[model samples]
Target: PLAAREASRVGAHRDAAGHYEVALRYSDALPMEGQAALHEGHAFECHLIGRIDAAMEAQGEARRLWQALGDRLKEGDSLRCLSRFAYLVGDRAAADRFGVQAVELLETAPDSAELAMAYSNLSQLAMLAERLDETLSLGAKAVGLAERLNRPDILCHALNNVGAAGQWLDFAKGRRDLARSLGIALAGNFQEHAARAFTNCACVEMNRLNLNEAEAFLDRGIAYCVENDLATWRDYMRGVQAQLLLRRGLWNEAATIAHDVVDDEATTALVRYPSLVALARLRIRRGDPSAGPVLDEMKRFLDKGMELQRLAPYAAVMAELAWLGQGDRAEALRLIDLAESRSPTRAVVGELATWRQFLSPDSDPGEIDGMAEPHRLLLAGDWRGAAAFWARIDAPFERALALLQGDEAAQREALDIFEGLGARPVAQHVRGLMRQSGVSHIARGPRQATRTNLAGLTQRQMEVLQLIERGFSNKKIAAHLTISPKTVDHHVSAVLEKLEAVSRGEATAAARASGLL
Candidate 1:
């Protein structure tokens, strides 16, 4: 029992679970309190490995034992464990009941660590429900309590919850808090907390379009999960890696990764939902007629009232599939409306707005600027105008879509860009169009540098450099780009490294010399 408890504490979940099962077989020989403690340890290990049914069963037994012994604190801890299990299994109603009961029981208890944990569980529940403000408040309380108690475990969980809440409220502060949480977890050898922090930080970077940084974080996260036998987190990181692949336009690889996640029977619905949508989107972009089934599956999840945070991106992708693949203008409009209603962030709203305009030209999409301008022009039936706008923005995919309606020379140019980006599915679609047109030996036109330049800076890095040259500070640049300052810092570092410069001024000068500014 002690070995099982120690293993669980150190994040050796699989070994802990094994030892727990062995101990449970002889638990009848132990005293009531020992039996209760053993069951609780088993429950926690089971929960860590995503064995929801086993966790709930063990925790229920533990709770019953503790109650029989009149141990309110241990019973409350069991309730908190049950709450987390319920939340993971998507039973938010049950989770809230358990969470509230735990908090109420622990409120008057002298154990600050336990009380902090109760608050952290409540905060996590709030986060899942999209109650960001409540999450922040509860998480702050938990953090304060944990810090006062000097409990590393509770502190790590509280910090992660608070940082995640901040991500939706203020990106700069969120990134900093998440980074600090990761540092603390690592320094304290809290493997589970460190893995979770890595995943959250990578998600932030991914949202900011910092693909390189996101990948780096994901790599570390995946390694940690593998080393510790964290099955659920490993799968979750794989799903995130698939998302990064999709953003990079690696269609074949992305589809494969998403397919694996969706097809795995062991995978939870929370992870499978996004993977299914990603797979469906890739299929639609690849011109596959079979994408309809995938879309239908994703729609079923949406209809079940998934959390708004997940629904936003799912609805946006469904809108695109409806418009582009199914030709269901009405459905497209409805999905876009859903996307807008669920999206809490400006970046997501802008993306959905771009799709909304594509489906309904008469609908005012507000100021047409940035990446969406070309899309709006395309929707207005100004193919040449859209193409020109895309070319100016250096957006090859939009340019390709625009040229699909006209301009064979420009279409070939767009194809070259897709091919260079390893966007196999998109390139294949473009190639089919080229073959149908019987175009050959097209004249080369002036093109912006590909994603990678002679100076080895990515397109995003080049944009950051340009903004820096325009005298924008990191915070201002983050606001301008709708990314986090941490992401801006990453870009600045990359720019400096690639230019072999020691300062921002020197980096800007080097970029200008390389004709990148």
Candidate 2:
């Protein structure tokens, strides 16, 4: 079993599986205590291979074996791992119950480090279940336990939860907590863990509209990641860097980097959504509604999963959905709330939540008090207001949004802007796309088919068609145009006939494509 586990650790998958099988067969002849250890090892290997169901089975068997051997601590650890597997498989209620049992059994265990695992798992479970209040309470408990344990690895895990708890607090509170976590992580001497901590700090800064601080923290983290050869960190840092570029108005660079990042194999689906959404927004800003389809793609991804993947990117998708006139503007807000509740002390979700609240109809966006506000203002379609607001930020993401939203002729000019900002990857990406076969610089999609123009439509008919395109309910349109809902229906039929569109969304897309909007 030990050989199998070590082989698995060394990445010899086939060899490890064979060795695990051999261990299982040999364990059939051993005492229950020996068998439990063997089965526990087998289950651990199964987990490492992503055979989650098999892992559960092995874990169950191991728990029985451990119980027979009277090894309560091993049984508790096995239960905790199994509970996490169940949670991952959509059995949260079961996970919750098992988690409580795991902790109860661990209560008198003298090893603080072992006990910290149970605490961390419980905290994670609370966060995943969207119990924000529970998340904070559990997070606090986990951090205290990890501190008492005084183990670096355990401390790293606890700091993550602390950051998450702070994430739910308002700006100053979130910042103070993440900074303290940062100091602890740096003191722990795990470069990768410290890098992650720095990234979280950047998120808090981003949320507070402190772009300068965010940029500095993100840059430092990325540099650390590069130095450490951490694949996961590199991918994450790139995503954060891409967003900051867009914030800074480094349009071409942000878009270009976003384009590249989306295709990186190391990028998770969580990373994929944000990169694409950012790219899609850039396309929209570039005066291309083709982003409509891209935004739809992101919305679909947002609906798929939760867990570590459910936080930052999901909120970005929800915000885009609302912006694009998907029904239930509140769905976006609801998702933001969910992400905030479920994620541990992380920067992206909290910061994005802050930004979303700032941009919300119910709040004063200016409370964020950053140069990013100009773009927030520009979201209502005021280019000049945003352009003047651009100088206050030096972020790449804002520039990418600017280039995307800028006039087509101005895109070339924006390329120089990206180069000036030292974002060569982005500039190189855009320059590489200077020409493409069968691609339109300006997208002209099914535009009511110039062949089927609305020439014969009367004034009243045009009003109805516009309302329909705007997603107005028939009753609502009737009130707007001072006509009966039935009368509005007749106008919609006539407009669809003239435009040859099958649905109001199609008609609206056509109308916008034809410059009617």
Candidate 3:
């Protein structure tokens, strides 16, 4: 037990689990309480190492032992562990049942850390289930109790749940709470809590479209997880990273990371969720035939829980795929209805609304307050505005989508961008639209190598290179492109890097040499 504790203290989770297993082998010599403690310790280590089955079995044993010994507090602690394990394994019903039982059992005990944790557990479950009001109430109780007890870990746990959920209603207040939780975890050297804090912080930034901030948090979180041997959190953070890359228009890198995480057999559903979303969205855009199977696999996650985060993304993906003139539009509409009814956060509503726009192009979505910027622009039928925003953020795919909402000239430009990105699925759809609209003399898209661009320059970057070749300054390019100089600067830097050049002159030379001019 001492060895296990020491190993866990140093972040050697696998070693801790092994030590706990050895201790448990001889635990029969100990009293009931000692045996239960061993089981609980082993379960925690197993949980950290992503051994859900072993964690559940050990926690169950601990729960039974505590129940037999008439220790309600210990039993409740075990139940909370079981609840967490169940949730990680995508058994939402079982998780909810275990959490409720845990809270009920702990309520009968005196004020303690265990009871606070029970409240936090239920709070987390409520948040994931999108019961925001219940989430806040339970989280408040947990936070209050944890504060009074001076339990930093419990406080961090409660704040994380409440803060993330609170963002749906109030972004600033939620961010403050999340920041506070992260501060506490860092100060206390709570490695697991810190990893979670980093993950949640990244998630919040990503939700608000603060791509730079999100990337910073992801970098720190992934590094911390690697240092601490937190494979599960590492994988979850990696999945989120893939999503961020997808949003940033780094599709090939995003697809690679997503596929790596999703294809790994040991990944839990929780870790797989975001990566699967990235993969499905990417494949759908590229018109990959395997997209259907990927989307179907994502759908199976809903059988575990109908959380807004899950439902909204799934609905948006399905809606877009359906709008591409495939799949069942009716089913996609049904999902949109369900997501809007559950938790209509502006981000969710905006995403669903943007996709829903295509399903019924004539139906104006009107104006929505606090809608995300790109969605707001799209909803207002300002394709240029939307495209400019995506360009500033370096999201070429979304910019292309935005351009598709414009006239023949804009649509032709959109087709060029899609072809440049190797988005054949959407490119074909655009070609069909052009044929219908009687736009003649369409240029054949870039060859396979050109579409995949040997220099790895995006369409926007290619345009920036052409302007550079004309000896246009960043300021001039920004004015010509209707974007900010800062954005132009960013594109210039990316172009220079991709061409492996030290100056604009060298970049132009490299572009000419590679026939990208």
Candidate 4:
């Protein structure tokens, strides 16, 4: 029992499973509670190693044993585990059933830790179902209980669920909660909890368009998972890394990593879908003929019933594919409506508005009044204005999309940016546009040096510059990038010197004006 417990504590899941199995062989000679505990331990190890069938079997036995022993608390714990397992397998109905049962069982239980965990599980289920208000309420209860009980693990789980749900509902609170959870997990040496905290924090950064900070967090997460032999989380972080790469206009690298994730047989549907979406987006952006088939695959996945939390992203991507690839305005509008129905958060609404504009350039601009700057301009039929706005924001892909709707000169500028970023697919599309416009003598030579040459800046320096542009303080940047404040200071100094600016704001403005952003 001690060996099994130690193995499980250190994340040696397979070894723990073996030890638990050996202990279970002598179950008849053990006490009822001991037998139930052995089965529960075996179930957890199996679940960790992706043996879902075995885990379910063991957990069912454990739950039955707990019930026979009249241990409501242990039964509630088993139900919570089952709830998580059902959720992992994409069975929301079963997950809800188990979670509700767990909560009911724990309501009268005196053990604050068990009750806290039960509430946490229910909160996670609520989040997955897109019940944001319910998620926050349940998470608050879980947090209060865990704090009173002094249970760090329950608190971490509650914080993660609430923080993730808050990202779409309340950004500032989400960031604070996720950051606090990360600090607690790190200080407590809770490897799994820390990994989840890192992932949630990265998602928050991505939402804020702080791609560099998101990438840094993902890198740390990947390293931590590898060091601890966490195969599932490693794959999930790789998917997120692919997403960050895609956003940075590194299409080839993004496609390679995304394909690896999609091809991994061990990955769950939840982990695989984002990678698939990234790959499809990359293919479509590059104007690949294969994009149609990928979009079809996404449609099939949607038909299989995705979690409500993922519906908005899936619908947003489909809206783009419908507009750009199929040229079906009606289908695109339907997808946009679907996305808005799912979340209607700022990001989703903005993306939907952009797709609507792309589909119908003559549409009423007033319909998208509260959209983001670039989307608002694009929807208003000011393609050139949108291009300039995105360029000023250092969003090259968006700038290119805006420019694609403009005149020859704008197309030429967009092509230059695309080629400079090594976006071969987008550059090919731009070249085709040039050919169709009867502008034959296209200059395909190496790019000329600009007046504001940012080539002097290293990758790290560029990351620092972006954070600086986002108004992150030196300490905040250091924390986000996982570097010493002293290192951040040096990077900031180098960025200022390379940009030839007197202050951070001046450097940001200079970079934007020079098109070196």
Which predicted model would earn the best TM-score?
Answer: 3
Off by over 4 Å in 4: 25-28, 286-297, 304-308, 364-373, 380-395, 415-517
**TM-scores for every candidate against the unseen true structure:** 0.72, 0.53, 0.85, 0.76
Report the C-alpha displacement of residue 351, candidate 2, in angstroms: 9.8
Clashes of each: 0, 24, 0, 0
lDDT of 3 at 7: 89
Question: Highest lDDT: which candidate?
Answer: 3
lDDT of each: 0.73, 0.61, 0.85, 0.75
Question: Judged by lDDT against the true structure, how good is candidate 2?
Answer: 0.61
Superposed by TM-score, candidate 1 places the C-alpha of residue 43 at a distance from the truth, in angstroms, of 1.9
Candidate 2 residue runs with Cα over 4 Å from true position: 1-70, 78-101, 108-111, 124-132, 167-173, 189-192, 226-229, 251-276, 283-390, 395-517
Judged by whole-model lDDT over C-alpha atoms, candidate 1 comes out at: 0.73
Candidate 2 contains a number of clashing pairs equal to: 24
Stretches of candidate 3 above 4 Å error?
A: 364-367, 446-517
Which model, 2 or 3, shows the larger lDDT?
3
Q: Write the per-residue lDDT of candidate 2 for residues 438-470, one digit (tens) a residue.
A: 224532222433423434667677667644543
Kindly list the per-residue Cα lDDT of model 1 for residues 436-500, writing each as its tens digit: 68977643322347424768888888778755654456876797689999999999998899999
Segments in model 1 whose C-alpha atoms lie over 4 Å from true places: 9-11, 108-111, 288-293, 325-327, 366-517
